[model samples]
Target: MHLPEIRRSHIAIAVISGLLFSLSFRLNQYFDALFVYSAGISLLFLPAGVKLLAVLVGRLPAIVGIMVVSVHLGASIWPDKPMTAIVYFAFVSLMTYPIATLGVMRLFHIRKNLSNLRYHHIVVLSVVASILNGLVHNWLYLAQGVTTSEELWHKSAAMALGDFMGCFVVVAFFHAAMGVLRSARNPQID
Candidate 1:
């Protein structure tokens, strides 16, 4: 996109999402669990704001880059083991973002109209994204050295389920964010 147009919006969304996720981080000692849960919400809700900014600026690449870098940095500094966190970020970006983007685009016939995707489409996208997210977690576990194929599969399944749950949370958050954005964009007679 135009870069300039969306830069402000992207920054705003990133800041807000980062703050919200940080709040989640403080809520529990099981930092990984809390981060993953917050991540799902962040992915679903945050992307739209990013997309909005991208469209305005015509700087999709910058938006994506910012997201990847932010997530990577977050993972690098997370309380959990650094390696595991990096793996999680990689999976979320590589696998999750693509799958969710595809599933939602296909389901809604979105045609890349990122600015106006329906809420349901966003939810579907988030679900797919979450599934990919879980896969990444499982992959990380395996990379640490899986003893058996069955163990690998088991971890994979568990990660998938966790991703799905996280996706759902993200979808809910996305809808709320969309509503707020819509209201702000169209304040009317009351």
Candidate 2:
């Protein structure tokens, strides 16, 4: 059985991935949710360069950094309790990765660390993770005594979509670039 090696280069890409995600930041006043996102619908619907769960896990530090900055951007959503917002956001980001990773493993029968995932597998994981992201964020809103169900739904959907889109866009770009480089070196290869 082949095991996945933890490449420093990949890990570095992970860190940089967070930066790319950060570049996706934008505000949607309707939901009062400030978030970073990429218009990656084109790639999100398709199977792109979705990395393995273990590899993504290795990028936890960078992911956490991105989460901190992202949450801070929306601190005004809970101006009176900014700390509460930060803590909850951080907690969700930390907890989601492990739980979702387990979900991916069970759902896809992937026991190997950092093994390549199938396209459908990646899509399934993306949807599940998005729901988890939305649920946690929405739960926080409810806990804070917000009662507008419609707005709650909107916020959750926006946040989930933003994250998903950003990731998808980044993956698509990376794969496309690699393909271009590979094709350049081999004229016969397509």
Candidate 3:
């Protein structure tokens, strides 16, 4: 219900989802077993680190987005299969990161005080983070000889769409979670 409680719930959900997804991939042979294992590790640790940094820096959402992007970048560079690496990075940065960051932001009502200037700032930060995330993944794939310029452009477009979709899902989840928490915290009033 409170900020701390909400944070815990988010972390728990993220962890559970990450684990379930990784296990599913492993079971279905969607990825290399090692890759799926590594992804699971990253999902558990990277977001937690990002959230801590964000909280300490007092720019929670933006910093979390950046760190999530950084995680994707690192993952992209570590894989032998460039396409797989790029896809993984895209999923995490463009899909998971945006959703998680937006969820936390909306849950806390962080945009309540936004003026046009502040709104612009938030949008700019999110866009920058998303672009940087896509570029990093694309660059990795290019460096690994996995994709040409045309393919890179296509992937970039997909990355952008993933980011938008992620943001939408995360924001919606935040709203739902916040409502649930609010009700739990104030059952008598409700």
What are the models' TM-scores?
0.53, 0.57, 0.40
Ranking by lDDT: 2, 1, 3
Q: How many clashing pairs in candidate 1?
A: 9
lDDT tens string, model 2, 17-76?
Answer: 445444443322222223332221121221111322322444465455555554665474
- What residue pairs are clashing in model 2? 24-36, 24-37, 25-36
How do the residues 134-159 of candidate 3 rate in per-residue lDDT, one tens digit apiece?
55555555665655776786665454
What are the root-mean-square deviations of the candidates from the true structure over C-alphas?
A: 6.8, 7.6, 10.5
Q: Which of candidates 1 and 2 is the stronger one according to TM-score?
A: 2
Model 1, C-alpha of 185: deviation from truth (Å): 7.9
By summed lDDT, the worst window of 10 consecutive residues in model 3 runs over 36-45
lDDT of each model, Cα atoms only?
0.50, 0.51, 0.44
Residue pair clashes in candidate 3: none
| TM match of model 1 to true structure | 0.53
Pick by TM-score: 1 or 3, better one: 1
Ranking by TM-score: 2, 1, 3
